[model samples]
Target: MEIQSTKKLVFLLLFLPIIYTTAQPLIHHHLTILNDKAALLAFKDAITEDSQAVLADWQNSSNVCNFTGVVCNYQQNRVEQLRLNGGGIHGPLSPFLSNLTGLRLLDLSENNLVGPIPPELSSLWRLNELNLFGNLLHGPIPDSLSLLSGLFFIDLKGNHLTGIIPSSILYNCTSLGYIDLSENALHGEIPPEIGNRLLSLMFLQLYSNNLSGKLPPSLSNCTILKWLDVENNSLSGELPTQTVSRWKLLELLLLSNNLFTSHDHNTNLAPFFSALSNCTHLQGIELAGMGLGGQLPTTIDQLGMNLSSIYLQDNQIFGSIPPTIVNLSNLMVLNLSSNLLNGTIPDKIGRLQNLQSLILANNLLIGPIPPSIGQIDRLSQLDLSKNRLSGEVPGNLGNLTLLSDLFLQENKLSGISPSIGRCESLNKLDVSFNRLTAIPKEIFGLTLMENFLNLSHNLINGPLPLELSNMKSVHEIDLSSNSFHGSIFPQLEGCAAARMINLSHNSLEGKLPSMLELPENLESLDISFNSLSGEIPVSLGGSLSLVQLNLSYNDFNGPIPTSGRFTNFTSLSFLGNPHICGSIPGVPVCK
Candidate 1:
């Protein structure tokens, strides 16, 4: 019996070490899971308000892996992902999340989380994606985020983050492929250390920030880059011709609203345009409001066939609309407004059949609008206003059944064609500040004019159309500075959604229609500089939404009703009407 016991003891001693070795990792696995559970609990506690109850199951669940938005590894031992996006949870981000050492993704976007990003997040050594976008979080981006050397994507966009793009992140986070720190308060130059560093970066959106200074030339080293949006920044320097030429895979480039100058005294943009041709996949290019000078290069068509949108408005771009632009079969939106552009719009512009929005307003372009524009069946918005263009609008434009807005104001348009009424989808039509005469009867049929119907500052004559009442949902109607003669049409009261109604500076005669009831949303009314003579309508004073009123140079006599929200109106609102009387300051006292 003694010999048998000695043998068993030896066997037990040998098995004990093997058993302990095998059990060590199992013990560690449970402890790590427990730590993960604690981290999640802390996260849930940080949420002061979870109106949507997104985290309701978080507390009740026994296993942390089964909790809301938490994903565990295949072994069910560690948390790997936590996706709590757009849950309406209002709270500060918990720094305890860093304890989830094995976490690969942490997406807490579109929440109301406020406060600085916790620096402890750098401890997430295995994190691949960290998206905290669309939160109200304020303060500088934690520089220690660079410690996540293996991170591939990090988006902190739409936050209140302030400070420079840290040089450490640009220089060290080389594995990053996507970085969007846009729509924040980040200021300072993009660190030059990023030369050839972020070779895997495909997208870099730093738009709508306060970033200034010359774009580092080294950024061109990110050869695989697909999107680069640095618009709305105070960045100054010549267009980066050398830098852009290297972005062969670039798709979209928005460098607008910056202080960039063209090479060669701001007159030479050819180099920049030439460099852009290298990016065969380029689709959209927006350089608007950059104060760029020089003519639109005829070679602009070399910007690739995939290019769809080009916005170069609010600049000093001159020269005629190059017909070569029609060669880009995929072009969708072309906005060249508010520039010094002259010469007639290329008549061939209509060939861009896929075009949706075409804005050439506020330029010096003369000649009639090419009727060819109507050929773009997909055209939704067309703005050719504030130009020296003459002649009538091409009736074919009415072919655009999808047209929502057509702005031809501040031009020398001769007349409104009945064809415009064919645009049944028209939401807003502004032909103000033009020499327009003859209102097409079809205009009265545009009931979808919910935005505005402005024919002001024109030579249009004739009585106000009773058909105007058909615009039941029109927001504003301005036929002022015209020669319309007749009594104000009482049928106009049918426009119950009208907010602003201005028929001033016309030749209308007689009192306002006695049944002229104010619309529910009526805010402003101007009928001054007319020949109307009678007691002012008492309904005008009782306007609930009326804030601005003008009845000047008229022959109206009456006691202004002190009712509703119109009492705030002063004498200026009733000026030049010798018979007008009101108790409001600057108004003639009622007798």
Candidate 2:
């Protein structure tokens, strides 16, 4: 009996050690979870504001992995990611975040966090993504970030960060595929070894910075690059055609608002365009405001089938737009404005079925606007103003029910099309500086024309149509330089939103309409150069917002109101009216 008892004691002792060994992992896991919870609590404490209550779930009793913005690797029993984007949180990022060693992603973008990025983040070697864009963070990018070799994406845009980007970060973060430091105060030239060192880079955005110097020629080595945006910077010098051509996989290239010059002294844009043709996947090209000159290459047709948007405005590009541009059927926006280009718009431009905005304004274009433009049903805004275009406005333009802003002013277009009334979505219509003899009655039907209706500098004659009363949404109305002859219509007050009214240089006769009730927002009123002979309405000076008033060249005989907005006007505003007597200077005192 004694021997059996001793054996049982030995067995019990041996089994106890095995039980303890088996329970060790559970204790370690429990400690790790406790550590994660403590780290999160530290983070929550550092935030000064949490208006969105993004961290409300972070409590001691709650499972750390189940906390808000916290994600965990359940199998490994560790926190893996924290995404608190746009939570309205305000405060500096906590250095205690380094305690979450297992974190692979950390996103706190679009917040109000201020101060420098924590250089201690280098301790997180496993971090794959770190996004803090759209924050109020200020300070230079820390070079210590290069220690994070595993980082694949880093976005620090829209911040107040200053100083040069560290070269070590680009050279050591070889796995980085996307990096955006745009909209910051960063200056200095990009490292020459960027393309050679960071071969995995696919997207690089450094726009809206003070970065200067020519693009690094070594960038040609980044063969897999897709999107490259360096716009709105102080970057100068000629674009290396060889470097540009090497990006065969490139899709979007935005280099606008820079000081880049042509390689051949602005004599030819063909070489630059030819290099871009190598990128078969190119979709959008924005070179506006870049001092680019030379005729647009007819070879623009080779710019790939996926080309959708091309912004070449505010440049020195001259010559006619090549008809081959119509071949890009996928085009959605084509802006060639503020250039020196001249010639008729392509007749086949209607083939671009996807066109939504076609801006060819401020150019030297001539000839009648092609009637084919009406075929683009999707066109929303068309600006062909400040050109030499003549002939009658295309009536088929009314078929574009989606049209909103139509600017055909400063051209020789004559005759107003009645069909324009069919454009229910039209908001702005300016056909001034034309030779129309009659105002299209259909124009008054556009109740949605809220922007303005300028028919000035035209030969429009006959009595003003009463239909003008229906434009309740019109803000500014200028009918100057017309031959209209009639008393001002009292119904014109129905334009409840009128801000500026100019009926000068017209032969309208009879007394000024006394019942005219200008909108409360009215700022300027000019009725000079008319034969209207009557007492100026006393209520006209009561407008609180009126800044300028001109009643000269009229046969009106009355004392101008001495109160309200009338006190601000000078003698010049009442000049050219010999029959007037008022408190205004240069006018005889009312006796």
Candidate 3:
């Protein structure tokens, strides 16, 4: 028995070492996994709202590899990716995220997460993509973010982050291909080193920031850049002429709402257009509201063949609509509003078949609107308002089946076209401040006009069409300042969405519409300067939503009831109608 015991002890000692050695790696792997699981739990606890149960699967009893929004490397047993985008999660981002040391991709975008971005994220050396867009995160973007040398993509748009963009990111992060920090409160000049270091970057969106200063000339070095948007900033000074001319691969260049001035010595846009002509691949250019003053170059015809959109509105550009502009057959949007452009719209303007929006409002454009405009089959929005355009409106405009918004107000257009009734998709129709003797019956057939129907400041005369009842969705109807001589149509009450009705300054006579059954949302009623005669409708005074009621210059003879909305108005609302007496201040009490 003694000899057996000795042998057993020797055997136990020798084999115990081998057993422990064999299990060592397995034990270490388990500990690593446990650590990851704890980190994930901490992350879940940090989120205040996970309404979709996006993290409901995160439990201690389950395998960490199977947890929601977590991806683990089977070989290394570590979390490699975490995605919880648009999960309705709200709260400060947890600094514990740094514990996921092996993470390669992290996307928590489109969530309601508030608070500053965790500066600890700089520790993610292996992270390739980091997207936290559409969050409520505030504070200056941390300079430490430049430490992510391997990161190739980063998007932090739509946040409240303020402060100068750290220049270190442009000097470092050489692997970056895409960087979008747009729609934030970021300020300061963009670092010129961006073009020098990030040679591989293809996209850079820094629009809607408070960034000021001239664009860096070094940007010309980024030959591979495809998109550059610095719009809606305070950026001032001349645009980099050499850089724009050199962007051969550029597809989109949006620099709108800035203070950029033309660098051309002649104050002619010819040089700028000449420079852009070098970019054959350019598809869109927006320089609106930049106070750029110059004549649009006739050489604009020489621009990129693929150019699809051009927004140069709210500038000081003068000159006629260059006939050469027809060369851009691919143009989908052309907005030249609020400028000094004049002359007739080119007769060949219809050549742009892809036009979805053509805005030329608030210009000095004269002559008849070209009938060729009807050729744009894809026309959706047409704004020719505040122009001096004369002659009858082109009846062919009705050919636009997809036309949704038509603004020809403040023009000299005459004779309403019945063809307009063919526009089934019309949402808003305005032809005010024009010359017309009769309301086109076809105009009232627009059932889809939910925005408003304005025919004010026109010479239109006739009875109120019963067809008004068809406009159930119309929100406002303005037939004021016309020559319409008739009683208020009872059918007007059918416009259930009408929030405002202005029929003042017309020749409307006889008793007011017996019922005036306005929509519950009715806020304003202006029937002043007309011949409407009757006892004030008792219902008008009781309206809860009525805020402004102008019944002056009418023939109303009765006591204005002092209740509801009427109690709030002064006697001015009942002025010019001597027959009107009420409890309203400055007005005699009714006998």
Writing each residue's lDDT as its tens digit, candidate 2 over 345-379 gives 99889999999999999999999899899999999
Stretches off by above 4 angstroms in model 1 are 1-8, 49-52, 558-569, 580-591
lDDT of 2 at 353: 92
Answer with 1 or 3, whichever has the higher TM-score: 1
The estimated TM-scores of all candidates read: 0.96, 0.92, 0.93
lDDT of each: 0.89, 0.89, 0.88
Query: Considering every candidate listed, which one attains the maximal TM-score?
Result: 1
How many Å off is the CA of 451 in candidate 3?
0.7
For model 1, residues 383-410, the per-residue Cα lDDT tens digits are 9999998998899988999999999999
For 1-591, candidate 3 gives per-residue lDDT tens digits of 999999999999999999999999899788878887887788788877545377888888999889878889989888899988888888888888887778899999999889998899898889999999999999998899899999899999999999998999877999998999999999999996778888888899999999988898888888888999999999988766788887889999999998888866436677778899999998999999977888988889778679999999999998898899998999999999999998889999999999999999999999999999988999999999999988888899999999999999998888668898899999999999988777778999998789999999999888878898788898999999998888887666678788999989989889976576666787898989999888887777666888898989988898887666777999878898888788878988878
Q: Give the Å error, residue 79, model 1.
A: 0.8
Stretches > 4 Å off in candidate 2? 1-24, 49-52, 541-548, 562-589
